[model samples]
Structures are given as structure tokens and as C-alpha cells.
Target: MYPTDFIERINSLKKELETKTPLRIEDEKRLKKKLRLEFNYNSNHLEGNTLTYGQTELLLLHDKSTGDVKLSDIEEMKAHDVALSQIEEMARENERPLTESFICELNKLILVRPFWKEATDFNGNTTRKKIEIGKYKSTPNSVRLRNGEIHEYASVEATPAMMTDLIDWYRENEPSMHPVQLAALFHYKFVCIHPFDDGNGRVSRLIMNYILLKNNYPPIIIKSADKENYLTSLQKADTGKQLAIIEYVEQQAIWSLELSLKAANGEDLEEKGDIDKEIELLKREKLSKTTNFKSKNTVYDLINHLHDDLWNSISLQLLKFKDFYEKANNEIILNHELDQKLSLTIRDNFNLFKILAPAIKIAIKDNHLDSTDNFYDIKNLLWIWSYSSNKTATKDIEETIEMNLQLEFKFYEISLVNNKYELERNGSLISTTIIYQSKNDYDTRITSESINNILKSISKQLIKQIKEEE
Candidate 1:
């Protein structure tokens, strides 16, 4: 279905991406999550879901959401996450060709629980209809156009055979068709077939992305903001003008590629800093494109120091179990991808001393950390931590020790940031962070020695907990 020019463009971009096929696995993961959030937000928004981009990011990344939105919107947002996970898992684990069952499973996942809806029956009276989850629609489904015309999907009887034909067609043409063309055409055809009663559009988008992902192509986001254009392009396809939609898909693919390349090169994945104020108290910092800012030098330096300190504490904590690492010979690898949230205003306003947290992972060799009771094949343990700048608000410092055993224990709020140092029942357990200005007596008095002692105590407790759990 692709024209000569579209084919050439797709092929050239494909070849360019092929040269960079093996992106750093960490970058690949970060980019994948980034695209997933964008795709889910845009796709759901297209279907009249109200969650904003910021809300979507928070919900997906941190499982924390803030908005005046409906509960169905929240459920569907979460369901979309589960559905995306299902699609990726299928892509990774399923060896067989795409099947009717797989598509149905995707529908089921995106709508975790189904609810009944009122639709006009064949007799022209309203009836309560049970929208089946993970099954083909038994009732007639159609769409009414803006011009008061009706567009009907394949009959309920025809849905099964049409879906089978669609899958068969995909298998037959996938090898020869360019992926952009394959994905776009499949989306159009699937929408035309309208196999499901409720989630046809959503499932079609998912299937389209699945095709692109399976073919090693980056997923294209049909942005909801461009809804009019998307619908118009689909209409063009309905008129047997396939090149317009194919070209539209081609452009989105190109955008996806450009986005991936930018992210791979360590550019700011999102906009940072408030540019509203023309004149600042300090000059806007000129930053190198590589590290993004000169302040990153300071941040990285602090990160190195912090990493060493935390590593030392962990080492002392595990010193008695030297056999764990020595006899087992479990190597500890340091990955330097610090997840620093680059902010210009913070750097400009003050000497930004701390960075957003990154992590360190210690490989658990064989069954070294496994216990017979839990039978947990502990793969690798990790420590996630960061320091504070307190630029926006009083930063809450926390650290977590997580392993595949599903054991997570932490001393959350024992801080050097001018707070009470009382060691209570849980050794200064601060479940909820208290945010305010540091008291006069508590300010600027926290010393390295105090921090060292706290870490030492936390390490001992952590070690004790591990032993007890084992």
C-alpha cells in the first residue's frame, strides 16, 4: 500500500535505526517506559479518557495520582497499563503467530472488568446489553457519522471469520510489506471490521503497535490532539485512498525515530525550568549538550561520594557474611546511570548540591541469598537513594533495600536535615515525611559523624532483618 517515496523513507530510517539497533539496554528501557506513557496517554485521550499527561506519568511511574477525574478513568488508565504489559509479554514469550485468542486477551486486559450498556436493539428499542470481555461481540455494532449516515461493521456471524482472515492476511503479507504500511493498513482494516463492541479502536491501536514492535520498529503514537486529522486520514483510506494514511503513519514513525535518537543521546526527555522570568537573580547557566549542564559535574561528583559512602556502609553490614561474596564470589557491578532530574532553576537559584536518586544493584549469585522457607530465587538486590537540595521544599531523604525475595525494609526519615534524631521503637521510624523549615537549633548542625552513625545503625538493622527473614 506504500508509495515509492514512502517506501524509500521508511527503508532509509529502518536502515539508520538498524545501525543503532543495539542501543544501550538501560537507555532502551528508559525510552521504552517513556514511549509507553506517551502512547497510553495519547491513545486513551483519543478515546475520550480525561487523564492528563502529567497525571498519567505520575500514576504509571510512581503509582501516585492527583486529579479531579472519574474512577472509571483511573481504572481504565490502570487497565491500559496492564494491557500494554500483556502485549509486551506476548511479544516476548509467545512464539506462535498472532491469533484470535491473543487479540481477545488484549481486549480483556484493557477492560479488566466489563459493565453492561444500553444500546438500541434490532427491534429499535433500547435494551441492556452485556458487553462481553475477551469475547467476540454477539450483538450488532455500528457507528453513526457526523452527516447522519451509518457505518456498520461485520455482522456478529462474520466477525469470527473476518478476524481469522485478518490474521491470515497479516501473516501472508507481513514478510513483504513495510512495517509502517503493514501497521497502518491493519489498523484501518481492523477498525472497519469492528470485531469488539466497546474497545475496537483501542485494540486496533494496540494491534498496530504490536505489529510495529514485533518487526523491531518503534511504536507510533497517533496523538489525540490530532484527532481530526487521524479521522480524516482514516476516511481517506475508506475511500480507497490508502497512501494518505500510509504517509501519515510514515511521518509518525519518523517522529518516533527522532524522539528515540534524541533520548538515546541523553537529551532532556522533557522540558525543564521556568523560563517565565526574563531576568533571574543569577545568570542562566550555559550548559554543554553532552552532560546537559555544568552543574551535572557537581551532581555526579556528589553522587560518586554518596555511592562510596553507601557502599562502605553496606560492606561493613555484610562483613560477617564475607563468605557470601567471597566463597560465593558474587561480583558487584556498578552502573553509573544516575537518574538525575536536570533542573536549571535549581542550579541557577542556589548551589545545587544533591541530585535525584539513582541506584546500585548487587548480583546475588546462585541461591546465595535464598532461604528454604521463602524459596525465593533472589536474583539481585538494589539500594535506591539520593541526597537533598531542598530547592522546592524540604526534601525527604529515604533509602530502600529491595531484593527478589520481596523483602523491603528501610529506615525512612532518619535525616541530617535538621530534624529530631530520637530513636524510637523502630529506631526513629518516620512513616510519613514532615515538611517545614529547619528549626533554628537543628539547622546546619548535622555533621558527617552523625550521618555515619545513622548509616551504621541502619546497616546493622538491615543486616539483622535480612538474617531474621532468612
Candidate 2:
């Protein structure tokens, strides 16, 4: 719990931020950008993000980087930016109460998919644990303190109950407690629980900020340089002196408050290196302003790359469902033909494809995408399936389920399964596979990651549809 003076200080700052009530457009831009960069840089740095403040600015603000940095660092930083936007929007909706599912989704946002790490248990044994995105930890998690003592967290069996209690405690205390104390206390309690396998620190900080932002206070950033002090305050709190962490957080909150106050008054909000970051970004963008025309980047290549990706995805995944039905036969109707008609081709006919590609290109160019940009709209799959109801031939085939799957691929996203039943989801897994034109001409092929998301979404829908019918 915070002392009266501490609560007073935070409220005083919050009241000051409120007078700015509806900041000027430019002022809001400066304040919001600074807070975002500071929160992202410091929080991630505390967790050992190798990117410097400059790199963080370059990547997050400008969408370009000068030097070689770890890809994971870039990804996590970008992911954190997205998560920041999400939480900010979430904080504005006072009508919507926070739930455990939102917390799990926050975990997923901060820690993206296909991630693995080396996790060590309390007994000093290590195992490679793949991150189960949006899920609680199945194994134990602990920290080793000074004097070689192991500080353990809530057990797997207790985590669920503990998390529920934590949420209940917050909802009960929210209306009564000061925002600063409430947010800090929640952070401390979450750290004690460590519900997730990774990104708990980041998640706790974001959730803490969510509380502050919702209550009209500028979010604080625990400077990565102060990792020791921050941890020390937490360490102190762990030992029953609750004020230490709350005091430290309040100190950081004051800095954010002052910065925002300056922005409110329309003063120069740029720090020392802000100009240099801007200059570097300008230099990079200047070099890559105009995209060089590539003949190979026609709609044909787009359709081709997309066809292989979707066909392979559909073939490999849909075949698995064959065992689910007694008689299952699928016709992959990839109608990228010159005439707008349906013909289920077992394989893409090269001669017909060459003739059809230009017509499809002309059609898309006329309607949706540009001919000069070579982004001729999209390609589609109109696949149909005929299946017997039962997998085992116990009786005569009384029921037949005909399923038609429609897939459409645009520039960077894909939408699949919009027919026979209501199931559709879009995926943003395109990282230089479907699009052929690039600053650096990326290899024109499908990534396994893209295929995997498509497979998972499609398989989930098909399984549900089949089960419902049966």
C-alpha cells in the first residue's frame, strides 16, 4: 500500500494530465509517440532486448533499421508496439471489464507464435520449452536469488486458482484504491504468480500501464538501465516491504507526467538523439523511394506463388480428413482460368495457366488493383469435397456431406473457408512468399509458417463442421 503522500503525488499528476484534456493534435502526437517509445524500449531492454534506443526508434517509428540486429529482437519490439496500441484501445473501453481470456490474449500478443526457449527448473535441470502462446505454464518456474536460494512461484496445480484470486482481488479493490497503488500492487502480485512461461515481466508491465492509462495517467517506463534497482524494489517487496516497489514506480510515473505536461504546453519534446534517428531514417527512405519495375512481378507470378502455397496447404491438410469419412474425394477447383468458369483441375495446366494468367491480370487491373504496380488483385481456390458420413462401413452410406471451401489470397493476407457453413478467418502470415516484388527480391515460394496457420485454421473448421453434421 502507498502512503497518503505517494497517492497524493500520483493523483496530482493525473489531475495535471487531465487539464490537457483533449490535447492539441501535434501535442498529442508528440506525447503519445514518446510514451510509446519509452515504454517499449525500457520494458524490453529490462528483459534484455539488445536494440538500442536508436534502433528501437528506427524500427518502431520509421519501419527501417540500419544495421544487423537479431530478428527476434525486431519482431518482439514490433509485437510490443502492436500490443501497446491494443492495450491503449482496451483501456478506453470502461464498459468492458477485464477478463482472464484478455490476459491470455495479451500474453499471446507480447509473445508471438513459433517461439522456443531454454527453461531451467528449480533443481538446476534445463529443458527446451516451446512457448504455448496464450496458455499458462504447464511446468514449474522459479528464480535464483543471492545466497543461492531458490525463489519458487505458484505451482502448476495452484496457478489457475491463484490467477482467479488475483483477478478477483483487483476487481474488488479497483474502485477503492489509488490507481498508482493498485497498478503497482497488481504488478507485484502477477510477478509472484508468474502465470506464463515467458514474457510475464512484459505482460505485467503492460497490464500495469493499462490500469494507469485507463485511469488517465501517462504510463511509466522502468528504465532498462535501472533493471537492478527495479528488481531490487521488487526484491524488497517480496520480503514484505511493499512500499519500495510502489515508490519506485511512482518515481517513474512522475517522469512520464512531467514529459506529458511539457507536451501539453506545446514545448519541444525531442530528447538529445531524436534528430539523429530522424536523419538516419530519412537517409534510408530516400534510397528506397521508388520501386524498380520487375516484369516477373506480374499477376501471373502472384497467382503461381499463391497456387502452390494454397494447393500444398489444402492437399496436405485436407487429406488427413479422409480417414474421418468412409468415402472422401476432393476436387481442388483452382479456377484461375481465362473465362470465369469452374473447372476442377487435378493439377495446374501450364499451357492454360499461361493463357489464363494475362486475362486474370487484365480483369483485376480493370477492377481492383493497378496494372502498373503489377498488383492484379488476387487469386482464389474453389475446392469441393464429397464425403460419406461414417468412417467405418457399419451400414449403407446413408448420408453424404459435400463441402466447398473457397480460398482467396490478396497481397499479404489470406481468407479461407467461406462456404457450406459459416467459418472464416484471415491470416497475416505473408513474409515474402505471395508478393514477388521486393526491395530485395525475396525467394518466390511459400513459407512453412504460412502453410501452418492456414492448415490449423482450415483443419479446425473442417473438424468442427464434420462433427456438427455427424
Least accurate 10 contiguous residues by lDDT in model 2 = 429-438
The estimated TM-scores of all candidates read 0.56, 0.62
Off by over 4 Å in 2: 121-123, 272-470
- List the global CA lDDT of all models: 0.59, 0.67
lDDT of 1 by residue, 164-253 (tens): 999999999988987789998899889989998788889999988888888777888998878888888888888899887888888888
The local distance difference test score of model 2 is: 0.67
Residue 424 displacement in candidate 2 (angstroms): 46
Best by lDDT: 2
Q: What is the lDDT of residue 318 in candidate 1?
A: 39
Estimate the TM-score for candidate 2: 0.62
Residue-level lDDT of model 2, residues 1-470, one tens digit each, is 45744667767877887877789998999888888988999999988888777778878877765433454576789899999888899999998777889889989988877455778755567656767878999888888887688899899899999999999999999999888888999999999999998889999999999999898888888988778899899999989998988888888888888888899899988777778866755655564333322232533453444444444345545567666655444344433324333344322322222223234334444544344433422234343443444554333232212222222332232334324421121322211112111222211234446557766766776666556553
